[model samples]
Target chain A: MNTAALHKNESTKPAPATVNQYTFTPRVDIRETENGYNLEVEMPGVDKDGIDVNLEDGVLTILGRVQPDNQDGFEKAYAEYEVGNYERQFQISEIIDEEQIEASVKNGILTLELPKHAAAKPKRIEVKVG
Target chain B: MYSLERHLFNQLSGLNSLINGLPGGTTFAAPEGRSRRDEFPRLNIWKNDNAVVLTAEVPGVDPADIDLNITSDKIGISGELPSRNRAEGEAYQRLERSSGKFQRQVDLPFRIDTEKVSAECRNGVLKVRLQRAEADKPRKIAVKAA
Candidate 1:
């Protein structure tokens, strides 16, 4: 099966909000199995309560919010990456069982399991010899 | 006795503040064609008069695999990220996450008290707090009228 044809990366602009924090596209790894698809998203500094996964109209959106570190008495000495929230969306095909999808986060990585519908699963047939 | 060290620290602080005061904060030096692979596990540092706190983004890396080496004024971090395990029928559709060994070293503006340093890893981010060495701190001098 051509997996790329099944999933399309949608470049949807984030909704304008009152917050001034920048939004970054988190890196991801997608894997296809016999039963379902697995998605791993990297969102550092984001805890479990800070993530939101939503599926609507065949589009799956993931948002990870990171609270800016308090800089009270400390001065910023150096930085290599900007602190911000994460947002990404993907257009999922009909083969994905959106209702059965499961999402979990650990160690700053979010794993999403998109199970395939029973009808979409491959069927095995046995041949008999006369 | 600590005038030279204080002067050097002030100069470094001024330069760092200038760079960090930009609209988008400090960015990679290269103008274009730069990738995250160039500097795996990017870092952000904050410091006060007595201590410095450093945070690094290292998602999907286990805490046991991370290694830290600290000295009076420098710290080195090295770690290996394990690759995802795949079964027989599983295949990758999109593999943007890189897994391999990475190492980085940073120099602190003030001497560190190795004994007072502490490190912790939570939710894929590593936070290291290093306290300034006692001997390196500026001491007030009393004046006596002759």
Candidate 2:
């Protein structure tokens, strides 16, 4: 779609609470399910080889670089947007299976599955009254 | 002498906070404390010789979470990523993952063969390849010498 119109659509959606003072940031979508949670992040110009996903200090981080094909030493005549690296971090609690958390990237989308530990699942209690 | 260099390095870091930093862009920082459900999603478009390649990034978002639609010239991608709020008493050091409505509407730069705009999702990325309409493609003319 005319990307110009896409930009307009972004403004029509509720803006994030705070705008990035300066950063080539990716938009995010979060979801919760009965078994676990998932995080989907958008990285437009990033590629699989350039992406890095890591977990440290209970924080999961996804990072990648976006560098279009080089100019063969030719300077760009006109430019409006800048392509750079992208980084996003998340703080997760005990509900996730630290050892089982999964990650995958395709078509610039990164999918992380933070599955809950077996004991973390909800159980229906049986009620018995004498 | 080496100790002096180390001291100078520390001082330089303090002085160069903004000077050496990226201009109009910062290293992405993800938010904290929201677990297994919070995700950031994305979409992309690239023009090719005979087709337009469109990609959507849906990290941690299952294929079932996405919906794709297309017409002869317009395409829309929509999905609902489940949401899970932060647990109480947990402090979020930083949060960069975003969750909510994510939609992208792309207009074809050229007329496309809508029936052939193939789409698929695998490993979290949705790819749509749109081929040009037959009428839009250039055809060669045969010349017969009399």
Candidate 3:
């Protein structure tokens, strides 16, 4: 229902809280490393061509469509999961540089590089004696 | 579209709807929206007496590329699924299968000793054995005439 609560939900599928929602969305791991925060999202069946990244204001968003092989009139014995689009939104802080963000889709896991902004980075400045 | 819990609830309501005049009434049918089936890998879960079996259809994953983690209540499979596609020409059409990093976590209903959890990957099928802890095993008591 709530995005904040959805974030805490153990069923960590990245999609928003909707009805009859296809929750095949797998859980993703977001960890903060010494350099920056590393997001390792599990997005299987998504190709590089189908994936897209967008940054607006201070928010970063990733979207990808998982298309299936054409198998018409196929009879399924049973299916416990559903397929569809993959979308995730993250709040970006001043620490991350918007222009320097680089992304790559290897296999299905899309790795996005958010380099630390120059201002957010710590720098040493000598004290000037008046 | 919905949370896994909601999906489960919808499924449960569908199952409940079949039997009318029960505690709950019919809800909505399977409404389609954002489909996540394509987002994650194809995984199957089976239950047995001693342990719960899990298998994931990982076509490109190497045994060495897979990582396994076991805890007191759950098991995690994390690793990179291989994906090196050949260059396509005019004849190339569509690519369906997925590759790259994948991780799956399954929670066992019954408590199991994590130390005893054994896993083996063969033919892209990962078999995890979650042995039930001695304390959680059901014990049979002697029947006495009262």
Q: Pick the candidate with the highest TM-score.
A: 1
Would you list the rank order by TM-score, best first? 1, 2, 3
Chain A TM-score of prediction number 2: 0.68
List model 1 lDDT by residue over B1-146, tens digit each: 13442344345434211111111111112223223433768887899988999988888898889999999999899999986898996766566676889999999989989999899988888989999899999888998998
lDDT of 3 by residue, B1-146 (tens): 33443454345444221111111111113334423444334555555445555555443466678887877777777888555433322111112334577877766666777777667664334456667688888888999999
The residue-by-residue lDDT of candidate 3 on A35-113, one tens digit each, is 4444545455567786778877766667666655322333332233444556666556667777887777654566676
Model 1: DockQ against the native? 0.26
Tens digits of lDDT, candidate 2, B1-146: 33443344335333221111111122223333323222234445566546777665564455777878788787888886556465643222213444566776667667789888777775445667788788887788999998
Candidate 3 positional error at B101, Å? 14
Provide the lDDT at B118 for model 2. 79
CA lDDT of each candidate? 0.72, 0.53, 0.51
Q: DockQ for each of the predicted structures, in order?
A: 0.26, 0.08, 0.02
Each candidate's fnat, in order? 0.56, 0.09, 0.01
Residue A51 CA error for candidate 1 (Å)? 0.9
Model 3 chain B poorest 10 in a row by lDDT: B18-27
Better of 1 and 2 by DockQ: 1
What lDDT does candidate 1 reach at residue A15? 33
True contacts kept of 1: 0.56
Model 2 preserves the real interface contacts to a fraction of 0.09
